[model samples]
Target: MISKIIVSVLYFAVVFYLGYKGWQNTRKASDYMLAGRRMNPFVMAMSYGATFISTSAIIGFGGAAGLFGFSLLWLTVANVFIGIFLAMTVFGRRTRRMGLCLNCHTFPELLGRRFDSSFIQGFSGLIIFLFIPVYAAAVLIGISRMLEVSLNIPYDWALIGMTAILAVYVVTGGLKAVMYTDAFQGGIMMVMMIILLYYTYSALGGVTSAHQTLTDMAAMMPEKLQKGGMLGWTQGAKFGTPLWLVIYTTIIYGVGIGVLAQPQLAVRFMTVKSDKQLNRAVLFGGIFIPLMTGVAFIVGALSNAVFTARGGKIAIAQAGGNIDKIIPTYIEQVMPDWFAGLFLLGMFAAAMSTLSSQYHVGGTSLGRDVIERGLFKRVGTSAKASQIGVTVTILATLVWAWVLPESIIARATAFFFGLCAASFLPVYLLGLYWKGITKVAAKVSMVGGFAGSMLWLLFVHEKEAAGLGICQWLTGQPTLVSAATKGSWVWLLQWVDPNVVALPISFLLAVGVSLMTKPMRQEHLEQCWANF
Candidate 1:
């Protein structure tokens, strides 16, 4: 116990010290928000990767690997090539040039400037305010689950403690503090994950034994998993999920293409000073994000062998049979006390790093995008306005965190990612690459995607269907012919991943609307296009 407390104290001191130094360097709002717009490529890369892949990936996705088997490995591949490679090559340089050209600081501001529409800025800010908290709450739940497993703390206190600490550094120092702390935390995560991989492998005897054990276990999966085509990547049914319409949705579009639309990630492009810096950052991010995520998935799958050999038990009972607790449970049981402390701190680092970025992005969207342009122009440049925006954002997120409902961490995280991809990606990509995109089209696309995603979640998503008693009510009514004849309503709603539906809807709406409205002037087109 003394050892654990000592380790915790040392970790807190290091983080607070770095945050203090970052606060000292912050003099202007630009520095607080964008690191003075002169961050080095390596720091920016590590910070970006750290913010993107947090406890949600390590614990939440790791739990997914245990339950779904190796099929989910495709996401890591997509994340590397699409999220890193395509983002840098296709969007990075253009975004940096456009942002600098218009003096845009936040993503909503960037879109508002690109198309010459204050409506786009205000609408985009509203979407961020509504959806980002869901994602932030998911991150909070993931870290809280780990703490509950490792330290035997109640989940509510764990959530409160983690949220409070993250809020402090983010509110005090903003982006400069977030980047510097992310770099420091990123180092700890890399080292600790490597050690975890080593220890996890050794615990099961060796790699060969681990693979054999997993292969044996795969043969004994329950009918529910097998029927859903989740047995393995190669052997499952090709189409139509059993209960939920197991469409090819998991691999083709779910998480694979969704990374392109992440708002927290989009803002990173504005922080670097030049396109060359972005190029350099991509190379580093390409290697780091995949390595960390890939290793976590590998370790999570391998843990099944250890659990099976002990008693065929994969999860602890007190945590409500959640697969998300598997990685944390394994760490506490297998690793030494001191190393477990390091592991716990790494988990906290992952949570805090991602949380800080979310808060910073959401705050900027409120401050610069909505308030400054919408209703508070007279007080826009005042320090009080910025502080008020930040304070309100923090309070709103806190309310969402406090009232969060119980759900699997990965599904919740993916839901918000889907929301962002659906609502923002279409407009953002078009604004950067296509000069023909008009202000009216941009607004239509954003609103359409937002409505489509919400409808899907409310009426179609399994969790929502189950929670709202919709499925039960439908099943009870004999006159409801579809529910009686067809087993359940889960299939009707399970055709395509939300991103697949949302992206195309947003794109087509934008195109259709732009054609109907008058096009932008040739002079305006040439000015925006020349930068690329």
Candidate 2:
């Protein structure tokens, strides 16, 4: 506890100094929002990776790996090849160039300016302001659980305490403070994850020996898992299996591709001075993302060996059936006290880096993009409005943390990621590349995508469907239709990710609506395509 207190205190002091520096350097709104677009590539890369990967990836998905086994590593592959590489290279270059062309500061602002419509900006911001809290709550729950388990802090106190500290820096220092602290936190995360990966392998002997042990234990997998579609602990699920659908579509592909359209991630592109920074940032991101995600997945799967050897149980069993708690419990029980302290602080760093970015983006969406830009004619008073936005965002995170369930980290992360991909990806992609993307098409795509994602989650997806209890309340059944029913034979909606269904619906609408509607104005097209 003494070491824990010391590490936390020292870590916070550095964050405070960075926050103060950001405050000092920020004189104009541009500096507050984008650091005057002069940030170095290293900082941008660290910020992007830090913000993109968080407690949700570590605690939440790590927990998922414990239950689902090593197959979850597919997400790491997607996150690297697509989330990091393609996002930074293909998406980042265009976003930076076009954002500069339009002088757009926010993701929604870029979309709105591209189509010459304030409604698009406001609506998009409204979607973010509304849905992002669930994701933030997932991050909050990650560290809050660690504090609960490790330090014996009350959950409410931990939630409030963490949010208050984050709000201090986020509200005062803005994006500059957020980015600097993110870089620092990202360093902590990388170092700690490396130590964790080493400790995990060493706990089980060595890499080859440890994996062989897990492979030998395949027949010992829980009956529930095999029934749910898992073939073993060391391999992917059988094709046409329920667990296979969940892992491949919902967890892997959903989060992998969904990272492309993240509003918060998109805004980072405009913060850099040029595409050169983005190129360099990719090398950093390529290493950082893989380390963060790859280690989490590996450690989560390997934890089964440690748990069985020590407690005569599986990782999920030791965690009391909640996948979210597996990583925290594993660290506390299996790791040395000193490494545990460092890992705790690392988890804190992960949580803070993510939460600060979420709050900053959510607040900006509400204040600058929605209220100030959408409701008011003037933009000068948005600074104060942004504070209000941050406050609201903090309150929302607390509310969600209170209401959410255990083992929800990965699902919550995917839920938001999928929704954003469905709602924003098509419009964002079309707006960037297609001259035919009209305002009407953009608006319809967003609406269609949002509607499809929500409807499917509520009525179709099993865990969420069962959890909501809406179908039960309305029709006296678990889902809208029983799986045993003939009508449910076309159960793709039940098995596939909502994003898979929703994104295509959204893109087709975008392309079809765009085709039918009048093309963008010549002046709008010329402005958007100026430097492409």
Query: What are the per-residue Cα lDDT tens digits for candidate 1 across 124-189?
Result: 876786667777777788888888887888988888788778777777887888898888888888
In model 2, how large is the Cα lDDT of residue 43? 89
lDDT of 2 by residue, 124-200 (tens): 89999998999999999999989988888998999989989998989988889999999999999999999999988
Q: Which consecutive 10 residues in model 1 have the weakest lDDT in total?
A: 477-486
Clashing pairs in 1: 241-245, 241-246
lDDT of 2: 0.88
Candidate 1: segments with Cα more than 4 A from true spot: 232-238, 242-252, 315-320, 375-386, 469-492
Candidate 2 Cα outliers beyond 4 Å, as residue runs: 375-378, 483-492
lDDT of 1: 0.73
Q: Global lDDT of each model? A: 0.73, 0.88
